[model samples]
Target: MDGRPMTFAKMLEETYTDGIAVLHRGKLIYERYFGALKPHKPHIGMSVTKSFTGVLAGILVTEGKIDPQAPVTDYVPELKASAFGDARVHEVMDMTTGLEYTEVYTDRNSHVWGLRRANGMAPIPPNYDGPTTIFDFLVAQKKQGEHGKAFAYKTVNTDVLAWICRRASGLTLSDLLSERIWTQIGAEEDAHYHVDRIGTESGGGGLSTTLRDLARFGETMRNHGRFNGRQIVPSSVVEDISRGGDPEKFKPAGYTTLPGASYRNQWWVTHNPHGAYMARGVHGQGIYVDPKAEMVIARYASHPVAGNAANDPVTLPAYMALAKALIAGG
Candidate 1:
């Protein structure tokens, strides 16, 4: 050991994080829980759930169960009249759909809040009369720009893709994740998803899992979707995600915090030499995998800021620094 104390407990205490876990060479090197969080507790993953949805879609694609080139409406015909009618499945997976929904987390009236209401994450007014379900919200969305033209980080796109995954596989989001991933990855505990009154998993931002299980998932991806000597997800799926989407298209998204980042299959690609990529969520949930350094970091937090931009400056550099140190010691 370097004796520099990269323990998760220290990281959590110093950063004010809820939980932190680090895995190196498939072994737990550090782990910690703080502030109402425990090793066995299932902390909210926020949009980290989207990465699971994306991987499920990849499995469907690899199994020839879903066609990425096909119109999204092909699988969910109910959306034929909505903005997604003309969008391709890949567009949704890559978050390139130009939907009018705004993801401004700070705005109470933002489409993200509307999504929270529809998915039953937030309390709605008694007389509120908007789309009552996620599906309804999708069906009611209007076009903002042309699809496939640029990247727009919209949670609805993931929810739509999740619906497509469910329809194609005939499995709920939780079941698909459980069967295709959690169980196969040797997850330490069962994960749960927050659902609406009708019992629909909030595929966009509803999952909660132990910090160890979250690390297991990240390690699985780092190892090309294989864990416990089994192929949980097709290697190609991980390849596609790590390879990332078009950076040119991502530039217009204007993520000032991530100057050279690209969006791919709901994962954020840093495009650095270490090939570090991440599954990030609102309020600071993250699973970072650095292939070159053989490191994986899973974190769950409840920062007042919903945007990762506010947290990335400190967290991103720290992650890179730690990865480099791990590699140096090895």
Candidate 2:
């Protein structure tokens, strides 16, 4: 990536990339699958689902059914005693709720693990007694600090958004997606989210989709929510994400790999010269949209490392180099 051709095999090995698809000038330029991943198989999108949930919220926002400035409890009163009780809808969208939850993966006691259990992602023992639904897990969270004071990456915010979406629109996450985005965009396959005991879709990290489908969604976002001759997502929503949340709110998150980046509507705005932004998740899953170069790169990976820091150094440079090459060739 440093002024050299990237070694595809070497980078894939280093990052454990399962599937990748790249689009240039609004057309497919590259694609591949590896290591038990297939074109038809739907791999877990992880937190990439958050971006989808965020976009769906945008659809409701456009309909005048949901207001970003409204308090979450206005939609879901169940959160009245939790961290999200007094948080604004926009605060949840921006992940600044200041929840007491910790996401330490190695710590079995972390709130993330509890989230997994509640969202049907983890196995439950016979004697296990805890929150049995994503809603239950979310309502148990306690406030830790001042809301809207800082940006903290937490999965529960998306779950809360999903709940609000359901309450505001009277549609489940899966149903709303199919009715609004998936069907309109002409996705190749029917993607799904893992649901809890109560059949509540895990809006935070439960969606699974094929690599090509991921690219389609990324292209939809790149085109400002227009795809397949339809307005699948509102252009205003995409514009808001591209404009990004407050950099002052994002700086304290300590994402050294993402200097000058901001989180908005669950997308990461790089704020680089090319105006690149991305939908990122744990273990290297990402949908990078490079608007300046007119390119989109969708990837589904199973890297052994869960943190983006493990692969961002290699991936980000390669992505920019590809974007530059695509633009220069034209």
Candidate 3:
């Protein structure tokens, strides 16, 4: 550690992180555990799981098992009457679906919470008659704006994509991920997903894995979908995610924390010279990959704030600094 001490222990103490892992040039540079997190423990990935789902969809497309331009209704015909019925698989993958649901986490009655209830993460009321499953919740969504016109962050869109992955691959999300990604990449341990009553993986935000394994995934992406001597995911898939979607569409989303950032295939693109990208989750879960610098950072935290907006001020700068240090040292 020749650079200024950004040790994992110090990061945990300073950022209230549950776990932190850093990989530079595909080697573990630092790792630490805090607040009951263990090497084998699997903490919820939250929206970070969205990236996994997106990548899986990409793999399916590469294998000729799916077509991104196809209508989502082709896979989940039951959604034909819903807002997502006309949505393209690529639109959902890019989060350009124009759904009426709001993602305001501060509000108890927000549509995101309703999704949590439907996905079985939150307890439902006794007399609740809304959608009982994630699929149902998505099918019941109302159209708010035209699809493919703007970037709108909606969890239900990912859930619908997950369902498509399941239907297309003829396997559950967990099985598909394990077979296509986790095991192939030599994951340190088996990751698990929280399931609903009928055993549907939450898809939108329910997978969990240890910091080390998460770092491995980040490194895999940094390597353009190759890992552990295998092309676990097609290079084209990674290129699409790294290239990112239109910044103009992203501007309307109003992510003040990420100026000049774009979203594509469930990954957040910084569009900086280093070609940095990230998989982020609510409440401070992040996997930051800087391909030019050959650095990957996996962090899990239970920050007081629910959205990344609050943490980005400190985290974004810190990551850029760390990447610069790594590049200089190299």
Candidate 4:
């Protein structure tokens, strides 16, 4: 140890992490809970939900129910007038839709607020009435630029993919997830999502799951889709995400903390030596997978800041350091 006071403990304090579970070589090496969170309760997964959406998309694709190159209108005709109408399914999965939507959370009138209002996360004003359902808000989106030319971080892309998943599978995102992954993963508790007025799951950012279950998913991903003596997620899907998406496309997004990383199927691919990647949510939720070190970290936090920009510096370094320690000391 480099005289750096046990890094992970420091990170827990600095990031206001609610719970953390670390798995090394398929074993629980470290586990703890803080604040109001417990082992049994499901904490909000935030944008981590997008990663879940991505996994479901992979399942649908493997089942031959989804066509990545197909236009969004192939499934959701309501989006035919929206920007996504011209976009491919994979484009939405990769967030290259080129929509005019803004995700600036601090702004009162940002598109994110409108999304929150539709999904039951924000308070609806008595006198205001716009799109109250997720479907309505999505169809209202229009094009801003050329699709497939540049990567943009937009939550609505995941929502569109969720709708497409429903159309392709004839199953709601919740039910499809329950059938395809959750039950097979040996999750300790049932997970859920926040829904809209029409009971549509907010696939963009509304999942909730226990820290242990999150770790189970992470470990499954680390093992390339195998868990609990079965193939929970397809190995091909894991390989695609592990191989990563195009960095050239991801470069223009300019995430300061994620330099040289690509967004693929809603997962952030870190082109680091460890070949690390993460499913990240705003407010510090994550499933950091380091294939080289055979390690997976599942964390749920309520940091005062929403973006990982605040948490990544402290959390990422700590994770790498711990991975090194586990690998070398073993």
TM-score of every model?
0.96, 0.97, 0.96, 0.98
Q: Runs in model 2 with CA error above 4 Å?
A: 1-6, 125-127
Between prediction 3 and prediction 4, which has the larger lDDT?
4
> lDDT by residue for model 3 over 97-163, one digit each (tens)?
8888999999989999899888898898989887777867887999888999999888888899899
Q: Candidate 1 residues 92-137, lDDT tens each?
A: 9999998899999889989988999999988888899997788888
| Winning model by lDDT | 4
- What C-alpha lDDT, on a 0 to 100 scale, does residue 5 get in candidate 3? 51
Per-residue lDDT of candidate 4, residues 156-177 (tens digit): 9999999999999999999999
Worst window of 10 by summed lDDT in candidate 4 = 1-10
Q: How would you encode candidate 2's per-residue C-alpha lDDT over 1-73 as one tens digit per residue?
A: 2455567566777789999999986799899888899999999999899999999998899999999999999
lDDT of 2: 0.91
Which pairs of residues clash in candidate 2, taking residues 3 or more apart in a chain or in different chains?
none
After best superposition, candidate 4 residue 211: deviation in angstroms? Answer: 0.4
Candidate 4 clashing pairs? 283-306
Q: How close is candidate 2 to the true structure, as a TM-score?
A: 0.97
Top candidate on TM-score is 4
lDDT of 3 at 202: 89
TM-score of 3: 0.96
Ten-residue region with minimum lDDT total, candidate 3: 1-10
Residue 19 deviation, candidate 1, in Å? 0.8
